[model samples]
Target: MDTTTYPAPQHRTATTTAPPPRGPAATFALHLGAMAVAMLLGMLLLAPVATALADAAGWDQAAAGPEAEALVMAATMTLGMAVWMVHRGHGPRAVGEMTAAMVLPFAMGLAPYWAGLVSAADALVVGHVLMLPAMVGAMLLRRSEYTGGHAHIRARTAWGRAVEAVAHRWPTLLALGLTFDSWLRPGIPPAWTLLLLGAEYLVIGAVRREFHRDRLLAAHIAGFVLYLGLAAVAATTPATVAGPVIAAAWILHIAWDAALHRADRVTWRWYAEACAVIDLVVGVTVLLAL
Candidate 1:
């Protein structure tokens, strides 16, 4: 009777939506940040030992120091980063890709060296240059290998996770690349030169800011310019004055880096942190040498 007039019950289905895709700018920042983190840890844990490694690997002879050390930087950073990529679920493919980046440079440059077509210095320089493209290209390929925005693997130990976090960044590998590259400059590069370039750790983020007209651009540009002027002057100044000037530049630059990292102004803030540590190490060493 009454039930016969009642309408049939309706069933409702729920729809799930995927998260919004990150915008281009955001994507860029995320990638840079990843690389930065990788670099930061790389510098702190491995970069300093690169030189010693070069020496140990039979790269210590005359005219080979830069090349040897550069190779060490590339190998160390590549191996370190690959280990993390693997840790993050990238597997063997990542290891091969990353190692290829280092191997190609050596293959190309060393061929010339053994042929006597180039000096060790020249070959190392070629290798270093070759490495940039190889590493960057390998990193681009990594875009496909990354999953879930990064794999989630639980480390059995805190130290294992810490090591993983440090090793996972390709940016720091690039930064360490820069560190080794800087050593290739003629005459062991003045303390001021290293300081200036170390300050350049901010340049990547600075450039990224250029697109959005970030006000920090002016400060970054102005700082670089001022560094150049000061560096030039330090080139001529007595070591007594130059040492302190270089010291101030590096020490102050590290402080600036920490500040920007805090502000999230640095593209590779993680990279900057690593650079700061390296700066402190080098700055103290340079200061003591002076």
Candidate 2:
């Protein structure tokens, strides 16, 4: 050797680097894809329910007119999108924007259609065309969100979500009950109402052993027995007596439902709320009929 020692070749270790964040275009595409999928899935999940509600309400889309049908369709689509957006860690602002994007287009077009400036077919076509631009606008308003990594968290507690879901349906439930009353003419017999009330208590009492152990159960049982006796009396009595008894029973049950809902006892709060609506509506209907 030349008497000079060369430094040993420096050893180099390669350090891996994370891939860069997706570009804006890529992010936009990804969000669009996810939204498309979510919309599809939401439709799959919610369409049948919407259809059933429409059927229950006797919507008769053809007779109700295209605008009414379009409104329902828009609502269903928006609700689906909103639900998916929430699941994807979107906040309320994003959800609301998306809802507006889906609904506003269709809703706005109705004014022109009603003014006879556009035919029904033209209004529907324009609405459909506008939805994409509206949705894109909503996305652009929150560009950072779509570009950023998703945050997989829910803003609401399970109970809160349950209540929200029920809140949306209470109006529908009331409508359904009223529709049923319309169909049933004079409504179910008073005896049948008492029998149904007892059945409801049975469900409430059977849901948990804690309910059975509660002292309130004793009163509930007594109420159940009293209902049975009253049912028997209603079955045997004249319309004059049966009508008032049934109306009174329905009115009393409305108060009972309110109490149970406030106490958050026995049955689900949603069920109690629904029962109260049904009780009040049916009771009022009975009173009006009388």
Q: Which pairs of residues have clashing backbones in candidate 2?
A: none
Ten contiguous residues with the weakest lDDT in model 2: 11-20
Assess candidate 1 and give its lDDT: 0.60
TM for every model, in the order presented, reads 0.45, 0.51
Every candidate's lDDT: 0.60, 0.69
Top candidate when judged by lDDT against the true structure: 2
lDDT of 2 by residue, 1-290 (tens): 48987889964433222232788789777777777665555555455566667777987766777687677667766665665565555666777888889888887777799998988878877777888888888888888767667443343578646634543564344334334533345554547779788668666667764364567787687778877887888898889888888878887888778888898877778678778877777777777777
- Model 2 error, position 101 (Å): 5.2
**Model 1 misplacement above 4 A:** 1-78, 86-151, 168-188, 191-206, 210-229
